[model samples]
Target: MKIIAAGLLLMNVAFGQTQLRSLRAVPVPEPSGLSEYVRDKASLIRLGKVFFWDMQAGSDGVTACATCHFHAGADHRPQNSLVDPNSPFRVNAELSTVLFPLYLLSDPRNRNSAMVRDSGVRVGSAGTFRRIFEGIVPGQAAELGRDALDKPEFMRGDMQVRRVTPRNTPSVFNTVYYVRNFWDGRAGRTFDGFTVTGANEAEGPGVLVARNGGLERQRVRIDKASLAAQAVGPALDHLEMSYAGRTWPMLAKKLLSLPPLALQKVAIDDSVLGPLARKEGRGLEEQHTYFAMIQSAFEPKFWESSERLNAAGELDPMGEFTQVGHNFSLFWGLALQAYQSTLNSDASPFDRFMEGDSHALTPQEQEGMRLFQNAAGCTRCHNGAEFSAAAFNENGSTRADSFERTGVRPVGDDIGSGNGAFKSIGLRNVEFTGPYFHNGGQSTLEQVVDFYRRGGDFAPITGDLRAFAATPGQTAAIVAFLKALSDDRVRYERAPFDHPELCVPVGHEEDESGELKPGDVATSAAERWRGLAAVGAGGNAAPLQTFDEMLRKFGENGERAHTMNEACTASLASLLGR
Candidate 1:
């Protein structure tokens, strides 16, 4: 009788029509561990929030942490969704399939991995890996120059077209629950996944060093687990936040410039840049300005205070603080995490039905759920708590794995599946995170279901599940269940943002030749120093390289430096200049 009931239930689910109802999102809780810091000490999480919202930290003040991540419901949108072309700042604001780098902060508790490089650079070699390093390689810089040279118009100092980052910025919400970060699961263990508590610590040992008669590999114990170890990578990534192209001294110099009150209040490593600049007999004040600018970029309150002055009440502040940057970073990280923490889609009608809520799911929805678990093979990888194992594998390639193909072309090196194979995502908020697939090829939910129904994304016939073989009616039922996962109440907030001031201002124009506009400044303190350093370091150093030069040297060489930095910085300056 039980077996008969189960089969009947499946049949009803498949055949019945169901009305879609909206689900309310559970309220998210605040982050903990704030009071643990010393008296009046700001928690890293708080700082992260402030930093996330502060757009001044970037070259264009208009871009904040929210700019990329957007709201939790949106899945850091613009990923294949297309952007408003009329917008001057962002020509194409698509979400990437990869993650970017993070900069280093002078927290005493943080440590980083030693730069490791193998003598040989081979593509597609098994067990081979590559790590981004601090120093700009000659080949890389030259390529950047070429790209700059090519896109003279949009690539100009004040009007850059941002490059599509290698990876998509994952939603930082609920990230705390995951043990790892990034598609490859490389960053979670070392840095407490994103908390400032571990800010001063070194990265986990996942690297191997090979030298003459000496090859030692250091493996981290944390990698054995998943959820507890994923937040560490963003702390050191160049593309995400940490210093890219610039060095510790450069970053330190920027930090030291914050107002003295700001500087003394927080305990950053003063020695990294201070002592080095002093020893070199270089004026540390410029470096100080750089740091101050970075702080000012993030924290508006820290910059506005006039505490560093004499009896006459002159506003001659001593230190520099990008206070806005720090606060927003903490804020965004925590808020996103907070929301994500509450992202329990377990209460779906389908789940309630399983828990004896007879009215939880309509007949059609129940059939959809059963089909999802059984005949549809949807539950194969999309199972468990998150509906995904967070593991990477070919969901059956569009062609070889199945007979049907959706005509979606495979991206570069789509070799079956590899370590970086896209991790299976939970379907909790699947509706909001389209266009679907790792590369985001499919634009609609029906299209996605159709892709699977077709057995694979591409053409050529083979494999057991080759013909998704589902009738049109069955496909509709499954899609209906998928649609039920959408939660509309999850709102998004657009935070205000501005640009950061660069050390040396540069010229810019919107014309095609990448030439400087009239009234545009030509030099910056950073540029001067960078030029001198380049020349002193044996490269022909020009105080300012044209946009054309920057792109060619950096863009095409596969170095993928943030090409938009110069333009964003210039744009910020223009706004401030106004």
Candidate 2:
């Protein structure tokens, strides 16, 4: 009778018993022995939040982690999102206000059909300056040029016009649950204090060579901190945030001396930093320096020097100072992780529905959920409480070990992880995160549904997408379900989601050849850095809201409004007009 009941339950669920059983939010583990390293978790989170948004952390003193992830933890800017036309995954060649869906071959069913010309959308990217390098490998130091410091190359010439990322930016919200990060899963689960390459592949000693010539690596074992692992990638990434030949030590040295969030204002009532602001009664520049904050957050053993004084009583710059420089990278990584770990948006309508509030979801949304589980089979890849198989749960305390080829593009083009296998990202805030997929080929959820409806554009489709077939109404239902996943806390500035001010780059100035000139780079940097220096000089600086907040603050004019709802409506209207 028990066996029969189990079979009946499996029959009732659309995605079968296995998938239904997988859905549940797992609590993020607080880093063990964190208290030994950090004076207080809240203080560390506060410091981390400041560092995450601080433009001074970048080599150009402009880009921040928040620069690419300001809008609901994902990028929203459309300009400079275009990729090279010759790229195998290239969707479109033209730059326009609107991005169209990916072009399909003549026969919609044939995955290998020559894609239609002029049919792809512009990919989203972080607007960053360029560094000129003669012959530097990706992970090694470059031979510094004579003008490396003074006249450092700033996104000039034909090759350096728009700083577009190769892949679309994924949201950092709820990333603590992800076993690995990045679309390619290059950022591993085990952070080895330095590289994203996990324990097995990382080449460096895990120990922190101390200021007193003592080495320690086993003192802290930060497990389940993939977000910390992911935080270290973009700092030195030439395309994402750094100039050519920029080292981790260089970034560390610059930030240690400068004020945190030097380019942006901090709100007086910021949830994390409110106490600090209240005590100081001043903004970021006046209240605190990165050095002080780092010292406050970490143990003195990590930063204090034990070097013997010389005859002139001057400490060696290269000897004991190198340990402090290395400590900066460690603090940056772990602190960012500490801040981002609190970014779990688990209070969605769907969450309420799962918690026994049947009426939490509207009838349409419930129907969409039903379709997603059974007919759409979205749960095959996007399962569990975070709505992704890539996420870890308490019940299933194992690293997510699956990547799928969704047949979005040809196998030959950018064969990530051997034949187009991309990590299945969590879909919690799918509505706000536009230009979906690794390539950003689909501008709207409707297009994504259509792509699945036609069984995808590529051959050898994997997961439940192999059998996916949805009507227009069903697709709409699925989209409605996805919208229900959005949390109100994320929509509003509240608690953990509430953040300090940011001066995100909107668009870049282009030269005649469509390359970014040095003036353009300086102008972009200046725009972000404005009011930063003055804040230290007792100037009243207003906090800069994100692009989305600014858009909603001003009337939702065509130029300002870039929400998913607006984009979807425009896409539907364009389709109808066509």
Candidate 3:
């Protein structure tokens, strides 16, 4: 019976029923859990945007959320984006692209194999300077230097430098639809106004100060705010964004006193800054402190009395904690969630096609769409408006087809719910979000399609791929269909997606022993600023290259470029028509 069904599917493809299906339109919903203190949703969104890109938010006063998510909602910097040496699937000897066919999986230590050049696991780049110690240590925070390189502790190896995150950085675009954020789905659906596990545990100040001076623990119970829960994860994560021993209170204190984007320039017409916009300038400005923004965006009750008084009868930065100070995690989480919730990329070509605009997608794209739903079996996991089964339903229920074990790695390498199961990420802007997969083991869409074609590299695969076969043309059509998921506003950095200038580390400076020194990491801010000067005189932040441009610049002889119709054709030749 199964064989007959497969034969019938093939027959349907032969009879040209591929273009019969269309993607459903998933409308972007308003963010949940806005406090009564917030007078304007638009103002709150602006505050979220500012905080999202503000460098002062980091302990080093340089790194921002935008550092890793700079290009097309995903990191595009090639240097320093390599896998750790101890990683189970470590293949590349150094930082380089992961090539096709002979991927790094069979042997963990085989670096001298004959395969495509620059094909290794691509991890996201992070801050080079971190707290000198491994874990939380008292007095370490005071020893931190503004310039990590100049700090004797870091220079002499007393402090540990930042290391690559275990998994690749997922794009923040359209993340509002996720039922649970993170590859492990650790960010729960219920934001407890505190930690990711707050839903299960009921220990924290579960209430907020009411506008009329009343206090209650249940004032803020955010639902479907996984992005908010996910937002606070990186701020405290030692590997991704913070120094060890750093608490939300410490980060909040540091940010409250410092001016937002102190190290970078804010465009005068920045949507987030509005009336608070300072003169077109660089460096820190006297106006628009994070404290002021927080006060304006939130109810006065949340921040006005949340501080503890010191011996001198003044509010202390670290003396005592209040519901507001403790609620910094809540504010940080929700503000980011509010901003990211607006990053819906529903204006893609495929979106138009789904909305009944018949000519929005080309005939080839239409054919590809059909193949995506039928022959490719992509609809099994990537169904609905977001092209992902993990997305929240219109009625707010989570679809059961969320996580799957595609066998990207061997079964026991990184064990979780199903040994190797990872989130089925949305395909929107997939062309820009590469090296594919949670481990970033594949470099292009063709490689991704090929992986699915072979039913994954390891055993115990989750999805059925027995009927999942396609020709080269069919694969190319599928790639085209994926590209149609990209939204143009994201490519141009327009409105809700607009961000401040960010200086991101491209590579690390090597020490005497070839170890990465804290100060040796190179940043793109100066170069980006120079580029911004050459082309324009306005206050709008400069735009980074689209994924296509990055591919052309980084790929060998344009063979590795993205978005081009033939980009994956050559690499996929040997695997086609299987």
Off by over 4 Å in 3: 1-25, 31-37, 85-94, 97-122, 132-161, 207-220, 283-287, 306-323, 510-578
Model 1 alpha-carbon miss at residue 423, Å: 0.6
Candidate 2, backbone clash total? 3
Query: Which pairs of residues collide in model 3?
Result: 37-299, 97-118, 97-119, 98-119, 98-120, 99-119, 132-159, 206-217, 207-217, 509-520
Query: Which scores higher on lDDT, 1 or 2?
Result: 2
Candidate 2 has an lDDT of 0.60
What TM-score would you give candidate 1 relative to the actual structure?
A: 0.46
Query: What residue runs in model 1 are displaced by over 4 Å at the alpha carbon?
Result: 1-45, 59-62, 73-159, 168-170, 173-177, 188-243, 246-356, 391-420, 458-467, 491-578
lDDT tens per residue, model 1, 279-381: 3222233344433433423333322332333222222356332222222223233333432343334445555454445676777777787778778777554
* Candidate with better TM-score, 1 vs 2: 2
Reference-based TM-score of each model: 0.46, 0.78, 0.77
In order of listing, the candidates' clash counts read 130, 3, 10
List model 3 lDDT by residue over 1-578, tens digit each.
Answer: 55654554455345431222233335565455465546567667767877787655655445578767765677776555555434344211233332433364342222233334433344545553545323221212121433334423212233334456657788988888878888878888777767774364545545455445544445456778788788887777655667666677667656665556555555665555534555655533576667666776787767766546332224467665555556688788878888888778778888766555678899989899888888778877887676677877667777654788887776665554567788878888888787677777766787777777666666677765433667889889999988888776665566655556565545445556654443322421111111111111232233344443454464434333221221111111111111
lDDT of each structure? 0.33, 0.60, 0.60
